[model samples]
Target: MSRSVFSISRLASSCRSRLLELLFPPACVVCGEALDRPTPAAFCRACLHEFAEFHPPYCPGCGATVPQPLAAGKTCGHCGGGKTRYDLAVSLGPYEGLLREQLLRAKKPTGEQVAVALAHRLLQQHSEQLQAADIDVVCPVPMHWRRRLRRMTNSPSTMASVIAQQLGVPLASGLLVRRRYTLPQFQLSPTDRLTNVRSAFRVAAGHRLQSAHVLLVDDILTTGATVTQCSRALRHGGAARVTVAAVARSYSDR
Candidate 1:
């Protein structure tokens, strides 16, 4: 396209954005405050700041916080004895307060703005760890077709897309897929949670990781059942390394 055409197109898009803003007026998704201008993320500065990173003393295995700091290579009780599939984990913070509120919103179609904003914030904070992993592929824990259609959004995938773009990594959005629907993990006992998601995921046929180092993105982690199963699938499918990235981790069963 010619420079003149590109300029005209940009101008037209700007005008359309301004017109929509005048009609609907934007508000922050978290605090419900009015936005001063139109932007992809409708989050206000105050609410954005509230989405803090989970500090250290967290388990290097699953990103779950420990009561006290441990040695550099320590694993928490849940992750010890070779129980999990992912190599390590990172998260925005523990699941509580503002983080929990925003995650719930991000699960809804109406929360796309919140989801995207959170992804960018995550990249800002965890870029070093995520990049240091030498990530070769970015994948989201896949939602079942039926559930995804009902919810009209998958928060994890939104996050994976943003992180993948910022890192200039290939996103294999469909690399791993849920084989069947299981009851929400939170509703089941930790023991039952393991059973519920066990063998529930697999690398989709015709799509395999090439001994890749994967960054598996998800909205939350509790017992880590779902992601464990997903990581197992990735490992079996050809991912040489699997690192979990989530918005929050909760000790819901405890």
Candidate 2:
């Protein structure tokens, strides 16, 4: 019967998975600790606990963790400075501990699995806020074609695809394009970082972003200059609002 055949197929698949696990034991992505069973999440329990999530008392505009308590309705210095073009920004956690290592790994060719795991975690933590934002479209901060070719993968695009799928929103990957390849932002001073990214991004021709609520996804937010420039381009393209989401927030310069 068809039912019997289906049961046999499932059994075979389970046996194959178990055999593979025995042949090549799975290890945690962050610590290389052995896992009892195969897991797509890629992190072991101890390593997962080390990932610090950004909580309340953080900057609503830039998602940077505030060192001192502030009265409600007051903005952090970073937000008050008016450097970022996006209306709001949120991140999974500050760039440190296990989260930092995971992000570094996510940049390499073998780190796609880790990146997917991080994206899923981001979705789980901020799903409610993302839903409330009423985003019309999701777009990743684009990388220059040459850079993307060398990297073999774009983390922002990978994260954005997962977010769009979970949110049931359209992902406009080509809506914004990075025209010029610049040096990595982390190496530059804060002022120089702004200059490095200025006028580097452009909205793709014929892409109608007018009046659209766009969610801009990136891997890590350091000085916010890159996202700010990208936001400006989206605004010029007629996007009504822009919100940024990233896997980590770097406090090195802040």
Candidate 3:
């Protein structure tokens, strides 16, 4: 009797989904091609295939792809200076081509669906690395209140929430707060980028991250300044270690 009831419920849900699809046909977020059925991600197979994944020969410390392969645990020239505050960083892919287009779209109001799809992809591809890191909690690089209000959404927070849920880790969304508004990192020189975000983040009081391993989520990693600053704040708040996980990395210093 229970099995029969479950089957009926499943059938009803299938029918409802078909009805909805009929009412509003699903289209690929990237290409606008009609989809035969709903996909785990909103991308059509062709567009999904176009999305590149980052393969190694990358800097172990910063996750930046090196021009040539390096031995295990080797740092790239850029990260060899020991200047980064985060223990390590990882990104899904380079910030160009399809990934770039999708990420830019993700910043707009109409891009929530695609943004969610991208987050799902990020988790699918990087879950193993994240699990190996043994993170205790996940946190998004917080946006200033004013910017969040203006944007009506924080993509990093959204991605972090999804990642935390998938990894069964707690998300400390409120623990890290941005105290100052800084110029966009992309617009600043590498040196200026460092100063721009200096002292911009503060960990919330009463939220002790003592010896916690934190995974910091952000949409894009450029010069690494933003995440570095965020990592400093997390460490100051007593986090034992911080690792960054971003959707894309911009290789250009600018």
Question: Quick one: best TM-score, which candidate?
Answer: 3
lDDT of each: 0.83, 0.84, 0.83
Off by over 4 Å in 2: 1-28, 32-42, 67-74, 78-83, 252-254
Off by over 4 Å in 3: 1-11, 18-26, 34-37, 67-74, 78-83
Off by over 4 Å in 1: 1-27, 34-42, 48-52, 65-73, 77-83
User: Could you tell me the lDDT of residue 219 within candidate 1?
Assistant: 90
C-alpha-based local distance difference test score of model 2: 0.84
lDDT of 1: 0.83
Deviation from native of the Cα of residue 162 in model 1, angstroms: 1.5
Between candidates 2 and 3, the TM-score winner: 3
Q: Give me the displacement of residue 213 in model 3, in angstroms.
A: 1.3
lDDT of 2 by residue, 148-247 (tens): 8999888888889889988999999998998889988888898899899999999999899869999999999887889989999999999999999999
Superior by lDDT: candidate 2 or candidate 3: 2
Candidate 2 residue 134 Cα shift, in angstroms, is 1.0
Candidate 1 per-residue lDDT, tens place, 14-68, comes to: 9998898888898876777998875555578887667665666667777766788
Q: After superposition, how far is residue 18 of candidate 2 from its true place, in Å?
A: 10
